[model samples]
Target chain A: MSRLIIPLSAFFFFMAESTYADLFSGEHFNSSRIFVPHFLFIFILFLTIFGSTKYGIIYGFIFGFLFDVVYTEILGVYAFLFAFLALVVSRLMKLVHSNIFIAALISTAAIAALEILVYEANGLIKDTGMNFTEFATIRLLPTLLLNFAFIIILAFPIKRIIEKANFESD
Target chain B: MPQFFLNKRLIVLLVSIIILVALIGFSVREREKLSWPEQFLKDTTGFVQNIFHQPVQFVAGFVENVNDLQHTYQENKRLKTRLDEYVKLKTEVQELEKENVELRDILDKKESLRDFDPIQATIIARNPDMWHEKTIINRGKIHGVQKDMAVITSKGLIGKIKITTQFTSTVQLLSSMDPKNRISVGIYGKGTIYGFIEGFDQKERLLLMKKIPYDVKIKKGSEVVTSGLGGVFPRGLPVGKVEKVESDQYGLTQVAYVKPSAELYDLNHVIVVKRKISTTESSSGAGAEGDDL
Candidate 1:
């Protein structure tokens, strides 16, 4: 039962991502630009900060692969991005003390970095034809706001779960 | 401690980067087709998404319907007025359609205006990433959905099928400014002025129809529809209305910004049009170019 917690949580994240994806279709906004919520990444970042970096990377790789297969056209983009993000956040955690505030800040910055990296990589490959300023204003900003709200709502509960999972493993 | 020089993490990172690059390269080259593993994953995840999406969508629809209840009286009144006009126009259109068919039969024309079978599908999931502008529909290869087949709402054209699994397919929305996904469209007033819907202008929320002849006079509010010249999308599918026209950057041709009639963002149910152009008909039709009556 204890061992099942992590995988179950990962499944919850997947379900949450899809649920949020449906909820926030920008239907109320009536705008052309979309605001994609990276709820799964935020959950993985929580796992890295609280549980263990190695476990975080493992979860990141698995869930990111699932995300790529389901949401993206390319297979490796999200897998690489999520693992890289987990690795970066873990490294950054070494330099800074981890707390709800600092961890939230790090996660926000990491998500922004992830989105920018993806935007640039896609532009290089597919020539998505979106300029940087337009991307920043239309997609990146709204996405950050949406993820920040999720981080706030889920941060404490996720931190508690990760710590408990780590304790149980030990 | 030179043991630090043999960093295991660094080597793993380097190896993973190589693998990732190769994976991205392979996937990019094989964008049109999905590998079996990808298909399996997509189908499994699509099944999950369907389970999650349907209940949520039902609740959301219920809430929206409750919200719309206030406007129901006004909406019913307006719709009743439009229904009267629609009924009058329906008979006229039926008569014209029969006459047109008779005329086409007299001329021995094999192709009619709307010659495609439509597969109805409900959108199960949308990629929130925005950059992809993709929606996963419930129908796939089993339902005869193929790449490049047009997907439309009852209002207008929306997108085309990009990739398909056994039970699910991805639609590349017209709002996606992919250079390869250009749709051949024509303005349907006066003489037919043809152009390609090359890209979408995100700022203006309009599609950019480019390469129209400079001499062609495109009026604002003129209806734009698929010309069927590309042979992928059938003719007479409503695309949009021409919002504005401008001279090309080179001053050689005109470009029209079209506002698509379909509410692209809020798609629920869509029809996938499968064009069935026979090989013999195409081979014979190829010789008779510019003979459109």
Candidate 2:
């Protein structure tokens, strides 16, 4: 039953919950935006328990790659970074049995930071129109705010999901 | 011997930590190599998306219906008037069909246009970040939508098919503001204008076409269509119209702003061009990449 829920949630999160658009086009003033990444947050935790280190690594990779595939900015940079981030998050969670809220907040913040870093690095290497100072002020700051705000919203579900997994395991 | 055979919890913790470190190292070392596996994950996610989408779309349609009830009567009246116009148009079409058949009989030797085997699909998901980024459509390799095939709406160029699986395909929209959009656009009256189109900002949704030679006579409302230079898109599909033209500050070339004909935000359906892949094009790895599984 727990196995079924993880995959189902993973599927549902990617399919239904991730409906909001990212960056540049939408009005930035919508205060009621919910930052839940749905099954992705749960999926990360699921991978840590039942799957291998390889599964987490691939999860991170695909998380970022899917982002690039949909968004098409820095190519595979985000995909790679997400895969990397998931691996670390999974490891940390495995070590310390902490509150899911803090865990999710940290995970979201770390991934958001990593995403910004990759964007900066891509600009640096390619030397396109990306200005680091401008990116920080315009892009990263708002994104960080948005991502953390989302983390808070999703914390409840994260706790529920982790607890459910723990319950089933016990 | 007793020390070496430590606690089970410690062993699990140590093993988990080691796995974590290795995952970190692997992620950093080969970021570029992660595309294949990521593609696999996306494909699976897409399947899950398809199953869930039907119910979601049904609910959306229901909501739309409920919302439309307020305006439905008014819209119905308008549609009746439009339907009368369509009736007249249908009569005209019948006359034109007879004329077309006669013309076809006279001109017996028609060039074999490539068959466009299209699979009807729904737009399952769109990238939340970029409007012109990519769309995950509900048809894939099983439906014969190959990677690099051109996707278009009835209006104009949609984008190229980037990835495909058994049940879905992800498409990049032409509204990409990247510097790499070197599309061959043919203007009305004038033969051809070659330029790049990309996004500028949200407020003014304009595609900047770089470097129209200063000497060319391009007015405010010239029609632009794909020239089919690379055969990605068919010849003479309506791309957009020229918005404005100005000489570059550097004096090397002039630039024209093109307003895309397709209203991408409201897009519900799109047609994928199913041109035959040449032997050489198929051999080069485009064939193997976008499998749904």
Stretches of candidate 2 off by over 4 Å are A3-8, A22-80, A83-108, A124-146, A167-170, B1-43, B66-109, B112-117, B128-132, B177-180, B190-203, B275-293
Error of 2 at B273 (Å): 2.4
TM-score of the second chain for every model: 0.90, 0.66
lDDT of 2 by residue, A1-170 (tens): 76565445554555543444421223335331212232354455445434445655665565555555433434555555556566666566666665656565656566566746556555544333445665555556666666567667766665566456444434
Chain A TM-scores in order: 0.93, 0.65
Which pairs in model 1 have colliding backbones?
A: none
Model 1 residue B223 distance off true place after TM-score fit, in angstroms? 0.9
Model 1 spans with C-alpha error above 4 angstroms: A167-170, B1-6, B30-32, B108-110, B279-293
**What's model 1's lDDT at B106?**
95
The prediction achieving the highest lDDT against the true structure is 1
Worst 10 residues of 2 chain B by lDDT: B284-293
Q: Lowest-scoring 10 consecutive residues by lDDT in candidate 2 chain A?
A: A30-39
Error of 1 at B5 (Å): 9.0
